[model samples]
Target chain A: MTLILDYEAGNLASVKRACKEVGLDAEFCADGDQLRHAERVIFPGVGAAGSAMRSLAHRGLDEALREVILRGVPVLGICLGLQVSLDHSEENDTPTLGLIPGRVRRFNLDRTDLKVPHMGWNEVVPCRPHPVLAGIDPGDEFYFVHAYYTDPKVADCVLARTEYEHSFASAVGYNSYIGTQFHPEKSGRVGLRLLANFAAWDGQC
Target chain B: MLSKRVIACLDVRDGRLAKSIKFVDTKDIGDPVEKARAYYLDGLDELVFYDITASSDRRSIMLDVVESVASQVFIPLSVGGGIRSVSDATDLRLAGAEKINVNSAAVQRPALIDECAAAIGNQNVVLSMDVRRVEPTQALPSGYEIVINGGRQPMQMDALAWALDGERRGAGELVVNSIDADGTKEGYEIALTALISSSVRIPVIASGGAGKPEHLHQVLTEGKADAALVASMVHYGEYRVSDLKEYLQRQGLKMRMSW
Candidate 1:
């Protein structure tokens, strides 16, 4: 069964509904034991990074998530979920789990035309072949709502990129862990397909 | 490039789909869930459901309808109407709404904006203003006034000022609904939309008076709106969402055409 970590900062209902729509038998679990035994874990989050990290640490989910990743369990992070997996985030000056080698930086667009939070749908262009993005088209649009994005220190970790002011890492996959800056749960059919791909993935890098 | 969005607005009254002419002459259309699913399948960008009677009835929002629609629809769903407090925002968020829009309540108590933004993220809290054009005055310098209670009462606050205040209080997006153009099928209130869109740095959705695809294109381009919200055009089957999107795409306005 797939486990959706209820870190108290995530949109648990929408993510759960999306998983159910894609025929993925997922349950919301805040327990560490469930995270360790789950076949796949979806670490979906929203809100501020500092508060989210504090909640994760409070629930001991921070270490449990790192342990799950070390065990080679397939994990997918969404929005702030992807950010907290990085080394540090400029939002609230918070330190993260460091599951992915990167720092989350705020979008410093030179142009005044671009809006902050980067709300709405934008195209996601794949950088390399990955199982998580198997059926997703090159110009497929996914829903994104974030001011900060993950900048993977290692280029190989970036599976896809999107442009909004500048090209930022929209999707990253390192080992068995994969994450997307956009909310696949709210991205309609394309997002469902991505989640379905994750459900069927074998947790291989 | 970020494509312009075409959002379908469904006004639900007591668990059924309803439409009004400038907030009067209410008429029943169809089921909310069915219409939402149809719009979703027809390749619409997003969906907004407003419980039209919730605020006037002095009760909580219809969570059952929201839950039903959210379960069936897989796109970004924003729920509005009767969201007065942070708890209401939390309830809607838990009911699977991606965003919570506050209208009259925010004007009554601006702190609700801060409170909801604190409870949920600012990105999920939307400030939906029902604006009407009026003569320019010192107090209403922009010539547009904020209306509440389904456009029955007009607040003395200027539309531009309220928009900026909403942004200051942490509203992620602003939906400018023109009461003058509402249900008229003439076109959007370009001046009002442009005024708020230009003043605020956050994305603005131009609502009211979307008769055709050209009107949407005009609002998105000339009116300087990030998105356009439609009601009568799609609700009455006058145009399909796919056809509208194709028209916008042909007009050189980038739109997501993925099925």
Candidate 2:
């Protein structure tokens, strides 16, 4: 039973649908107890960091998620979910859950042609061997729509890297927690395969 | 490098999939969900669903179809047609649409773009414009005029100016649908596409005349479009999304190879 933590951010339905398509029994677990006891938790979000943190804090799921991660339960974060796991964010100058040793900063592209928000599909280059990227090809494209990105303090935590105006961390994994800067739910077959890999993972580092 | 996208646009009227010839002589093709599934399997980069009559009919969008198609297709789904307010955008988002496109409504009230962006995020708000070419007038110095209400009404706004305004108003993406070349299948209005695509930093999707794979390559490269929206070419079964994508890939355009 995989629980999709619901904290008022959008993309919950799409994430649940992706999990189901991957043959994982998933449910929206707004209740903290369900989130804590689920086999795996997918912390998905798509919004501002300040408001997302507020919603999680409002529902008291912030500490609940920390407890679940500390218990060696496999967890995956998507987009803003990846940003919120960092130490701090430039968006609203908000402090995040700090589950991953990193800070989220907006893209500072020097090129005039490069667009902000960084919307669309780009290649995901795997940096290390991890179960979440077991079947995904090194240059397989994933759907991305973000203005901010994660800069993990520990270089080894970087799972994959992608280039836009400049190369940035697109996926990160540490301990039992893994997060993707792109929306795997909307990335077609490659995305579904990644979700399945996460579902079958045994929470190994 | 970011790949060029091939999007399948379904113009649905009521509950059935409808295709138009130059925005008229409409004919029902097939089920939208089934077509969406076929496109999804064929590895189309994205999908766009427009409730064709919702705006002209003056009603809300068909959420049932949006929900049904969204459940089956797992790619980035963008829904448009009758999105008038922030609430309409919210409803579509709840129904599993990744992006909501505003056309006539945004022209009526430009603030609707900002409101929807605030309600959702800027990335989820798409501004779709129906544009027609005309002589360069004082009001529309770009020679392209903005048409609304399913291309039945013309506005004083210029296509290039409206696109820039939309981006400033917080629209994350823009769909420049050429009313003159829509459904003609002759080729994309490259001049119109290049004009708007170069003027905006946001991603621009060139909609309207997509007859062959070569047309897509032309727009994506020469026209500088981020994505190409296909209608009659794919809707009539003249070409599969895979065939078009493969042809584009061969032309040195970066495309996601599903198979």
Candidate 3:
């Protein structure tokens, strides 16, 4: 069973349904006990980083989430969940778990022509070989909705990236903790393939 | 980069597909699933089913119709009308809808955006505003008031300000429909749309007044909307999706046509 960390961050029903649609059972876990017993864990986030950071702090789920990912449990962070995995986010001016070495920065745009909160479906191209993205192709479209991205120094940490106003890291892999800026559940077939790969892969970190 | 979107808006009443001319003359447009699938194959990018029936004891969104369409189509589906609470949002999701659009109900309680955004991801919650250039009236900016209950009542709000506020309140995207131009096929209100688009941090969908392929191109290029939603033109077969996409490409707009 995959434990979905729930701190009122993002309980994407479709994400849960997508897992079930693929025949994997996931439980929304907001407590440490549930995380301790689960085989794997997922950090799903939607909404603003400021509000999300507040929600995580308010529920005290921030430390609980950090503990689980630090224990080397295969954990996946989606969107804002990925943002919170960093050291600091410009969004909420809040500090992240620092599980991954990076800072979340706003999209760098020279012109006001491009929209912020870069919403909608965009493509993802993986730069490194990893089990979760075993069969995915380059330039595969994935659903993305965010205003910030990570600037990590560790080259090995970058797994996938996509271009908008500029190219930025879309997915980062470190140890067993994986963070995806896109919602794999809503990303159609390619997304499901990535999730299925995650579900089947043995702890490799 | 995002491609131009062609939306098949299903107006349902009393649990069936309902379409009307100018919000009056009504008809059943066959099975919504078949209609939507035909559009999907025709290269439509998105689907929006407006619950025109919910307000009038005369209409209600057919959840059954939505479920049928959802099972057959994988594209993003947005359902609006009579969505008042988080339960309503969940009910639509359980019915297989990818997004729940709240209009009148959300303005009544801004926190409803939070309620829905918290339960379901904010991306799944769309806040659609029915805006019109009301006669320059009392203590308001530009006389652009938010219309609710199917444009039957006016709320004291500015369309431009609401766009930014909606995003701040946690709406994934804003669908700004120009009530004055809806179904007119005249063209989009570029000035109004651009004002709202530049004001907001999220992508804005331009709705109403799409008459020709040029209109789509104009709004997308000149108006600078991330996407344009066409309903009547596609529904009545005024123009084919193939023709529209080709026209957009010729005009130098980037769009992916998946067959």
Candidate 4:
């Protein structure tokens, strides 16, 4: 069964609903043991990174998540879930799970034309092929709402890039771990297509 | 590039889609969930559900409506109307709303914005202001005043000042609804919208007074609004969301049409 990590930072109801819509039966799993044994894990949330890390650590889910990725279990991280998967985040100066070699930085745009948080729908151009982004086209846009963005260290780790103030890694993956800066659950049909792709993805690039 | 958003505002009253002219003389339109699904199918960028009455007793009804709509419709859903405390905002967020809009409550106690932003991130907090064009006083230099309680009470607050203040208090976006042109279909208040949009760095949604697609074009281009919120134009089935997106796209504006 597909499990969504519930660390109190995510909108679990919406994610569960989207999974059901995509014909994927999913349930909220807060137990680290349950998460480790799950066939697929969907990590999703919105909020500060420090608090999210704290909550995960408090529940011992941080180590459990790292273990899940290392075991080749399919893992998908969304929004803050994606941010906390990196090495560190500028938000709260918190250290995050080092599943991917990178750091999360806040959007420091000097242009008045672009707003921080990037709260709207924008295009996600796939830079490389990945299973989770199978049907996402060049023109397909996803819902994004975050002040900070993932900046992966290795060039090959960047799966997709979106332009706002500059081209940032909107989607990143390393080994069995896949993360997106946008919310697939909230992007309408194109977004649902992404969730369906994730449901079918077998942790293979 | 971030495309300009086209938002459909559903003024829900008694669990039904309702509409009013100048925030009075309300009329039932239809079921909100059905209309929301229809708009979602038509490739509407975002949806906003404003509980028009927002009385304390009817809070659960609004949540049920939001939950149903968010479960079926997968666009970014923003809910406003009766959010008085951080818990209220949290409840809606848990019920599947991506953003919580604070208007009268924020004006009553501005700290509610900061509190909600702290609980939920700053990105999920939206400040929706009901603005009326008034004589430019020394205190209200922008020539606009803020109204509260569904446009019934005047707050004597300057629109420009409130917009800036809302931004300072951690509001991620602003919904500037012109009380003068709410249901008039004359088009948005260009000067007022432009004033707030230019003054604040956060994205501003130009709301109220969208008669046709060209009005949206004007507001998005000349008025410099990041998004245009429509109620009457799309509510009465006069124009479909696809028609508006197609018209705006033809007029050289980027819109999200790939549903």
Of 3 and 4, which scores higher on lDDT?
Answer: 4
lDDT tens string, model 3, A1-205?
7888787764455567667757778888777656667778888877677777777776667777777666777888898888888899898687877889989999878767677667666768899988887887775777677778888779899998888878899989998888899878756567777888888866584
Quote the true-contact fraction of every model.
Answer: 0.70, 0.57, 0.20, 0.83
List the candidate 3 regions with Cα displacement exceeding 4 Å: A48-73, A203-205, B2-4, B33-45, B55-76, B85-99, B105-125, B131-148, B152-172, B184-186, B198-201, B233-247, B256-259
Q: What is the lDDT of residue B200 in candidate 1?
A: 91
Question: What are the per-residue Cα lDDT tens digits for candidate 3 across B1-259?
Answer: 6555556677776766666655666787666777787876676667888877644543224667776776555567788888889988887777768788999888888899988888887678889998988666664576688888777787778877777778988888888888888867899888778888877767778988888888888888777788888777877777877788888978887664433
Which TM-score does chain B of candidate 1 obtain?
0.97
User: Which runs of model 1 end up more than 4 angstroms from their true locations?
Assistant: B54-61
TM-score of each: 0.98, 0.97, 0.80, 0.98
| TM-score for chain A in each prediction | 0.98, 0.98, 0.93, 0.98
Q: Quantify all predictions' global Cα lDDT against the true fold.
A: 0.91, 0.90, 0.77, 0.91
| lDDT tens digits, residue span A85-144, model 1 | 999999999989999999999999888889998999999999988998999988899999
lDDT tens readout by residue for model 1, B1-259 = 7989999999988888999889998889999999999999999999999988744543344788889888888889999988889888888888888899999999999999999988898999999999998999999999999989999999998999999999999999999999999999999998889888989999999999989788999999989999999998999999999999999999999999896
lDDT of 2 by residue, B131-249 (tens): 99999999999999999987889998999999999999999999999989897888899999999999998999999988988999999999999999998898888999999989998
Candidates 2 and 4 compared by DockQ, better number: 4
**TM-score, chain B, predicted structure 4:** 0.98
DockQ of each: 0.80, 0.69, 0.23, 0.81
Query: Candidate 2, which segments miss by more than 4 Å at Cα?
Result: B54-61
Question: What lDDT, from 0 to 1, does candidate 3 have?
Answer: 0.77
State the local distance difference test value for candidate 1. Answer: 0.91
Question: Per-residue alpha-carbon lDDT of model 4 for B52-161, expressed as tens digits?
Answer: 86566678998899999988999889999988999999889888898999999999999999999888878889999999999999988999999999899998899999
